[model samples]
Target chain A: MVLWIGGRAQGKLALAMQKWPEAKILDVSETDAKGKEELLRSLEDALKDERLVWNHFHLFVRRALLLGMEPSEIWEKVASFVDERPDLVVICDEIGNGIVPMEPEERRYREETGRMLCKLAAKADCVERIFCGIPVRIK
Target chain B: MMILIVGGSGCGKSAYAEKRIMELSLDGAMRYYLATMQVYGEEGRRKVQRHVELRKNKGMLTIEQTRDVSEALPKMQEGSKVVLLEDLGNLVANEMFGEDGAMTPWEIVADKIVMQLRQMNSSLDHLVIVSNNVFEDGIDYEEGTRDYLRALGMVNAELAGDATQVVEVVAGIPLMVKGKE
Candidate 1:
């Protein structure tokens, strides 16, 4: 299982599918971010089964971490709905340079996301970033 | 009859072929000039046009891709056996490689070329191929040049495999390598 994250145009998921044929995939997007409080709360509720969760983007991981959640604990929580499945992939958009975020929320999002990527990349077996339709191995 | 026609640079391979075709006076025969050179520049473009103009009659057909054994096969006319392939060295030297200017896997390329030659052997009546015989003066070569020579060696082996006649054209002289007359 692998986690793919990139911007709107990045074919991270597509690259993952091509690279890892054996992996089963799950995707979460901004569309699911309609209601933040409800979504986060509901996500916590859904993470009860204690199965392995391959986290893609930094949002859910960041949320749980900020809420004093450990990586193993967060993965354990999400495991419940994930069929107690041994492995899975999580994805998110990491490098979106559309426009410099003038707002506080946007800046925080950027900083936190960058930090999360750096941390995950060090621990993960394989870490990649897609730019201009080509994948670059970062870790 | 099988022969290997070899000559020095610009020793009249095209002219030799046209005269041979006219001399044979092949009735209802197909005369094809299998060309390997691709015209990416002015020199190439003009040279190719000159080859087309060198033809004696409208019976002459030009097959551009000489490197490809497969493409070279289909251009052969039905019921017409006599075939002429000119400047094989350029074709074998150039194509069948990648954009990095590196040669592709010669084993794979050799297999494909050999397979096509087999098909031609069974289909065509008489085959006349022209080569530059670059073996005269060997020089220090980089990886690409070395790979090309190896591939060319494979091509030579494959062509020699089915050729009943091999003639080496040297200084306007035809030296028979494996032919009866």
Candidate 2:
């Protein structure tokens, strides 16, 4: 698993595409996976392919939180999928840089997203941070 | 040498920048803290005060120039070796929106800021600039906020291009994006 992290519109997706042109690009942002079972099923299906670009994995966390699903539980499902697929590339935007949201749920989403990204980054075979469309391999 | 230190809010970029500037300074070399923020209320005042306290006994002078940053250049001492501009976000915002609440074209503001920063870099021995990662939030702000983000994004790109070194501090960990120590 290769974890690609960057700020919004920093070309994380473009880099992923450039690296894996023939890979399946599954944008989690467009996924309507509301409940845990739906999300797990969607993720499992996406990972079944040879190479898959999971764009906006952060949005999955947001959706999970919206559906009152625990972040750890979501991570468990994601971890299992990642463990099964070595050709998975997860792209996430770094959304924890801004001011903390005043809304409680928004704040929780940010925190959960950050934690999930960290865990993924630690376990991934490679981690790259994109800044201004420049890819820097951090791990 | 111009160093650009970037990071998220309260991620220790300021503290790290301060230490870096101090390390870069020579004995008897003049140091200036170019404060770009304009205090609006009690919270702002308290934040400024905290920064002031942090820099106390650091042998550095604070220059408050909310807008027209280049104007501060002429006032700097001849022996000034290092100047740490604590932020570029507030500077860009102030230039776009004046004290009287007038809005200026963001392109012009961004250009002016880049030009001013270039001038500062040319004049100073070591310039340590601090900037924030303003664009990662998914919230679709109003048009004005979006414009501000675009402007800031442009400014940051320019700064990074011109900088001799670029570092992003995350959780107090400085990740070198460009250039060596």
Score every model by TM-score: 0.50, 0.66
Q: Give lDDT tens digits, candidate 1, residues B1-181.
A: 3334555576665566556654444665666666766568888788778867766345677777746655777656567565666665676665666557666775676577667756665666555667665532223257666666566656664565466655545566655555554
> What TM-score does chain A reach in every model?
0.54, 0.94
Evaluated with DockQ, which candidate comes out highest?
2
Candidate 2 per-residue lDDT, tens place, B65-179, comes to 9988989888887865789997888998888887688888877887999998898789888899999887887675887777777677777767877888889899999988888
Where in model 1 is the C-alpha error above 4 Å? A1-139, B21-25, B56-58, B75-77, B100-102
* Candidate 2 Cα errors over 4 Å, as ranges: A1-3, A9-92, A96-127, A132-134, B41-56
Q: Is the docking of candidate 2 incorrect, acceptable, medium or high quality?
A: acceptable
Sorted into a CAPRI-style docking class, model 1 comes out as incorrect
* Residue-by-residue lDDT tens digits, candidate 1, A44-110: 4434433323434555655555555545565555545343443444555653333446766555555
Best-performing candidate as measured by TM-score = 2
